[model samples]
Target: MSEQIADTAPLGHAKHIRSWGNWAALILLVLGAVVMLFPLVILALNAFKTTEDYNMTGPLSFPAHMSLEGVISFWNTTDFPMKFANSLLISLVVSVVGVLLSVLNSFALGIGRVKGNTVILLFIMLANMVPQEALLYPLYIMFKAIGLYNTQWSMIIIFTIIQSAYGTYLLSAVYGTFPQAILEAATVDGASRWQTLLRIVLPVSWPTISVLFVFFFIWTWNEYMIPMAFLMSDSVQTVPLALATMQGQHTMAATDLAAAALLSIIPTIVFFVFFQRKLSQGIVAGSVK
Candidate 1:
């Protein structure tokens, strides 16, 4: 009877301690979420509040009356749709073109070994070591000399090259272990190298490729420095630059600025909603088995 009571008391105490720990963890998590989301919450609140109310209350204050005037006024002042379209188009092209080149380049370097040409791979690695900003001026001069500066072609090529190099680096490690048995069988059956790659390798790689697509797309969409330096026309400017142009003493008030900021984030939110699953898979896809 005494031993049983001793065990029961300890078990009950442990259970109580665990319950307290769980509650403490939950409270901490809720606090952390509130801290991280506080700015966005403030932004959303101010976005809907009337200018008078926003000015009268602090940023965190609850709106007495919500109004669409801030959103409507923001839409009126800028070419929001056009800027969105530009970012969308650029991001799509960069992801697709860049991933394609990465796959092909990875195959060539990692699997297409013919003459033991390691120097090419060495050069690619060396290129990646240099910061892109270091090459910006030289690239600008070369692009200008070649009459490609300030063109969509220039942006497309630059982003494609930069993104593909990183992609190739990632994918080469995956393809480096291509099943020799399968390749040998394909070759013995009179299947050409291209056929084996197109049929077998590419199909197997689609998941990883999809991940790279999202990665490059997000980077290209958010890229500000390159576009700011090269893209000259206001019509061709991307969403980030367009949002930046909204700032000034006279141009945008607090309410309108908050509204525009919230609106700018909607497309990115939609993008994550669509790609979240595939992206999660891709993150783990390239890991060593």
Candidate 2:
């Protein structure tokens, strides 16, 4: 009886230890989530506060009274709608153009097996590694000479070209892992290169395409430096440019700035939420091969 009791005691103790470990892990995960979310929570709360309340109260504290005055002021004083439209237009155009350019470049390098493909790819990868600031001055001079300065098209083309290298690299890696037999079969069946890419490859690579699309959209939307450099006119200012101007000039209340920042993040968050599953799958697909 004592032996059985001793064995039972150890078993119970083992179970207790495991239960404690699980609980500890759960607590830590919850705490980490809270830490990550704290800034966003603060931003949301402050958006409804008056400038006075925002300054006086702790960021974590509830507002003494809720007010939409900050949001209203932001909307009225700033060209929020126009800035949003400009950003949206720029982001969409860049995303589409960037993806198409990347796809074509990747197909040429990966499937065309063209002479000097590796050398060209290496040059592009090296170029992508160079800091943006390093190229800014030269780009400015070239754009000025071409009369592209202060035009939205200049911003679109610059972003698309700069972004294309990474996108091409990513898509090439993906295409490299695709089965060669599929390409061979298509060729044997007399399917043209364009048809094979459009029909066979793209059909199976939607996840990667979605991932690139979302990535380019987010990058272009949040892009500040390029737009700031090329889009000098107020009429051409994107959302980030407008936000920067607002903050620098102190034309908007602090609460309103917070609100604007939160608003800017909403589209990005929505895009991610909508495509999160596909994004994850694409990442996994890329990593696995």
Candidate 3:
């Protein structure tokens, strides 16, 4: 009876301690979320404020007087619609091209069993080791020689080429783990090389592909330097370049600049919010398999 009571007391104490710990963790999590979210909250609030109101009122305060003046001014002054279109076009094209090249190269390396495959893979990996900035002038000259300078195609091609190496490496590693029996069976069934890859290999690798798609999309969307260097036309300026232009305009208010910066992030935020579940599922599937 004494031993049972002692055991029961400790178990009760442990239960209470665990409950307290859970509560503490929940509190900390909520606090951290609030801390991280505060800037975005402020930006959203400030977007509705007039430049004067934004300057006069504290960042945390409700707009002393609500006005869409800032948003209106931004819309009127900036070529936001055009910039948005340019950014979307560039990101989509680059992501698609980059993923395709990466997947093709990775598939070849993983399944080909060619004698020099390792050497080729090593060279590709080594290419990415060089700093991108170091390659800029040479790339610029090469593109110029090819009549691609200052064109959207120049930016797209550069991004695709640079991004392909990393993507290829990742996809190759993932493909290497796939069962060899599947490939053998596909071959034995008289499936051509293209048919085997298209029907058998790609169907099973959707999760890895999806993850890579999202990664490439985000990277291309966020790319600033390449676009800045290669796309010189005001009409072709991407969202980041447009943001930089906003900074250069002397008359633009700081609040408006902040508001514009916040506006630029909205598309990416919306994309993630919509696709987050798919992205998470892809990640889980890739990691588990």
Candidate 4:
């Protein structure tokens, strides 16, 4: 009894310390979330307010009455529908094409017996490490030469190039988990490489693909730099550019700007709401051999 009490005394003390540590970590997380979310919460509150209400009370003041007028005005000023369509088209096209290209490139590099595959993959990885700012002038000249400058096509091309590298890296990691015996069996059954890839690999790898698709979708949707640099026309402007132009000289009402920001986030939020479960599944599937 004496020995047991002695042993448990240290264990009890350690357990008490661990309990306090867990509580400390949780409190820190809560504080961090509040810090990050406070601005967004403020944005939401002000989004429902008017400029008059904003001026009369304070930025943090609860509204005397909620108003939709600012959001309506924001829609009018920004040409919201056309801007939305442009962003949607660009993001969709880029994600689809980029992810497809990544799948093919990843397969070739991850599973193929071809000579220089590692060298090629190394070069591709190096290409990914090079930042867009470094390539901007060259891309501008090339696009101008090809007559794609200032067009949506330029955004499309550049987005594909940037996104495909990351997608390839992600798919390769997941593909490395595929069973070699299964691939060999398919080859022994007289399946061509393309047939094996299409029929065998794709079916098994779809969960990872779904995750990559959504990841690329979010990245391309939020992309502002390429579109800003390339898309000069108002007709081709994306959501970020549209929202950005609302700042400065055009000088939209602060509340209206807040409203517009909230409005723009709706689609992405809906996407997450629907696919969040699948995202969890995909991540788990990719991780497990």
Which candidate ranks first by lDDT, i.e. highest?
2
What overall lDDT goes with each candidate model? 0.83, 0.86, 0.82, 0.85
Write down the lDDT that model 3 would get. 0.82
What digit string (tens of lDDT, one per residue) describes model 3 on residues 148-234?
Answer: 898788878888888888888888878877799988998898999899888987888876777777777788878888788888888
Arrange candidates by lDDT, descending.
Answer: 2, 4, 1, 3
Best by TM-score: 2
lDDT of 4 by residue, 1-289 (tens): 9999999899878765656779999999999999998987888888999899999998888888999987898789889999999888988898899989999988987877447876877777899999878888999899999999988888888989788988887777667767899999998999999999999999888877878778877888888876778888889999888888787437677888889998787777677778788788888875675
**Candidate 3 segments whose C-alpha is farther than 4 A from its true place:** 1-32
In the range 156-261, model 1's lDDT, one tens digit per residue, is 8889998998898878877888888887888899988789889888887777888898889888888888887888787787888777777742467788889988
Q: What is the clash count of model 2?
A: 0
Q: Write down the TM-score for model 2.
A: 0.87
Residue pairs whose backbone atoms clash in candidate 1? none
- The candidate with the higher TM-score, 1 or 4, is 4
Off by over 4 Å in 1: 1-38, 114-118, 248-251
- Report lDDT (Cα) of residue 13, candidate 1: 85
Local lDDT at 53 for model 1? 91
Write down the TM-score for model 3: 0.86
Candidate 3 versus truth, CA RMSD in Å, comes to: 4.4
Residue 273 of model 4, lDDT score: 73
Using Cα atoms with residue i matched to residue i, what is each candidate's TM-score against the true structure? Answer: 0.81, 0.87, 0.86, 0.86
